[model samples]
Target chain A: MALKFLVVDDSVTMRRIVMNSLKQIGHENFVEAADGRDALIKLNSDDSINFIITDWNMPDVSGLELVKQVRANPKTANLPVLMVTTRGMKEDIIEALNAKVNNYIVKPFTPQVLREKIEQIISTVNV
Target chain B: MELTNSMEKLFEKLGDLKSFFIYGQKLIPTLQKILNFMQDTVPLLESVNKSIAESTSKIPKATNQLHSVSNATELATTEILDLVDGISNELNSIFSKTSELKNRLQKQKELAEKLKSKYQNDNEIDEFLSYSLFDDELCFVDASSNKIQESIMNITIALQVQDITAQQLASVNHLINSIQEKLSGLLLDLNGKERESDKSSSQHESITFNENARYVKDNQSQKLADSLVAQTNGVKSQKEIDQLFSNKNE
Candidate 1:
């Protein structure tokens, strides 16, 4: 079974690159959002999206806010989230963990790291 | 008695005028000094106001140039990505075609083996074997395909630098705009203009960005971030455990 992904980032370039990486890792089903605000709207509308990969520091509602919203809602609380971002600071990563991101990825990541993170999340969620 | 009262009234009036004259004498020099100070300070104030205006005027242009750089990089990145995607697609086509041919070649070799076993006396079957799809040829195609795919992924990874650098630039832009706003306020104060009440003040919030965003060539930060996350998950890293024991022993 193919897992659907919601790939969220403000950059069009990052969005395409993430989707391209996902495709390389053999997961083709994707929904793209330009920011966290759009990601929430898409989540509310789409039921099949099981995985979310988001970038922090977006324009309006950020990825952290979106993750918090996901955790607050009983419907999507258990869904897996992987934060792919350039914010690699210790405090930033800790803040994200407190926000309940399942795993974190710093950007400029190789395809292998990406695949490993995604698979790690899927496996952990499965367990 | 009436004459004495009139005399006292005249003296009183004269004394009041003498005091008034003395007060005027004292005030005249002070007033002149104030005028002199104003004459001396006017040009200095004017120069400051002019300096502020000049500085503030150039800021918008600097910001606009930064904006231009961001836009130019974004455009270039998009074009490069388009080409990279094309190349990736070509690699995909090559990979699929090679895999399909390999499968077909395997079927041919299997059929050839069956015929050889059926015809034991046919030694010519060995000579008739198809050497077209050699192992080395397929291996070369697979290896090259892997190498090209890796290169495409690396290009994609490198393009992430654009986004990182753009964020850093944005942080700078935000700072410059803030400085510009502060200077504009200072200019208004210096010019003695009433700050036009900003009707839209703080009513709508604009985007806030990470001020400390920066680009690093290598993502060594990830390893540290991962350890932090692991710790938060109640998983102790080996280094942390060792440090804890060493501290306890000490």
Candidate 2:
């Protein structure tokens, strides 16, 4: 099976752009959710989702909260999650790091940067 | 002598009290003026409150309109993105067809040259042999093809602005709703009612927004993000470090 990505964001435009960007970089398998709560539902239903690309500042549950839940559950504890967000401050980055995202990419990222980070994470992980 | 002194002192105090009563009578008009001033401001205060209530009522409408704008732009952006994707696919197909055309032209030229050698004086073979249908056409298309693909990619990249603007509008919406909630609370208080608990008028008001979101045309923020990710990805994360210390204590 191909690597299925669970992309979580509140904005429909963001989800489309992210999925499109992923397709541009040769990763076509994608599952999208509009918010963190919806992301958890998708994660629960699809055990095939190997990687997670999430955005922070979502409604209901935040990206940080979602990552914490993913980590807390042993079933998805070790899955590699990357945060793509508009938060560029050092403290926000540190907070995300503490939440244990494999890597971080700021918003308005080029496909090249996404490819670079995805390749980096794929190298270190089983996926 | 003591008795006379006490009587004189008492008389002096009585005179002072009589003078005070005279001044007190004079102060009544001034006191009435202040009372009249208070009565005059009662209507002005109500007018100010009415204005605040009216403005506060408009906030929800403003936020709704903002949401409408965000949705409209996102719809337009999605349509543009779909068109770009379709054009990119068509461009790829054009490139492959041009490559095939180039190959077919090469073979035709070779065949015509071979026939010319057999029939050196044949006019048709000579005409076919010298015919270069696309001498510089393929080369020019190939060069411009890259530029076109690049332009298409740029269009896709710039579409990120819609998402960025949506986030910005969301941030603004959150701000507006929060103000609305506060103004509602203030209005409630100004109407001489007991202050109620913190109940937000809009459910979205409670959701936090990313205030720092913006459309940065440059990659400077990404560079900083890259450096931070680099710094953190190398080592055990802060959570891991915390876990390690906790485990050691155990």
Best by DockQ: 2
List the DockQ of the predictions in order: 0.50, 0.56
Q: Give the alpha carbon lDDT tens digit for every residue of B1-250 in model 1.
A: 9999999999999999999999999999999999999998999889989999899888877877776797799889999999999999999899899989989888888887888899977877676665644778899989989998888888998898888878877777777777777877899999889766432322212434566656665668889777765654533344553443343333
Angstrom error at residue A62, model 1 = 0.8
RMSD of 2: 4.1
Worst 10 residues of 2 chain B by lDDT: B241-250
TM-score of chain B of 2: 0.81
- Candidate 1 residue spans exceeding 4 A from truth: B1-45, B111-133, B197-208, B234-250
For candidate 2, the per-residue lDDT at B157 reads 76
What is the C-alpha lDDT profile of model 2 across A67-103, one tens digit per residue?
A: 9999999999988999999888766876777778898
Candidate 1 is graded, for docking, as medium
TM-score of chain A of each: 0.97, 0.98
Q: Relative to the true interface, what fraction of contacts does candidate 2 keep?
A: 0.66
Task: Provide backbone clash counts, one per model.
Answer: 0, 0
Give me the overall lDDT of model 1.
Answer: 0.82
- lDDT per residue (tens digit) for residues B20-90 in model 2: 99999999999999999999999999998998899987887788788789879989998898898898898
Instruction: Tell me how far the alpha carbon of residue B149 in candidate 1 is from the true structure, in angstroms, after superposition.
Output: 0.9
> How does each model score on TM-score?
0.78, 0.85
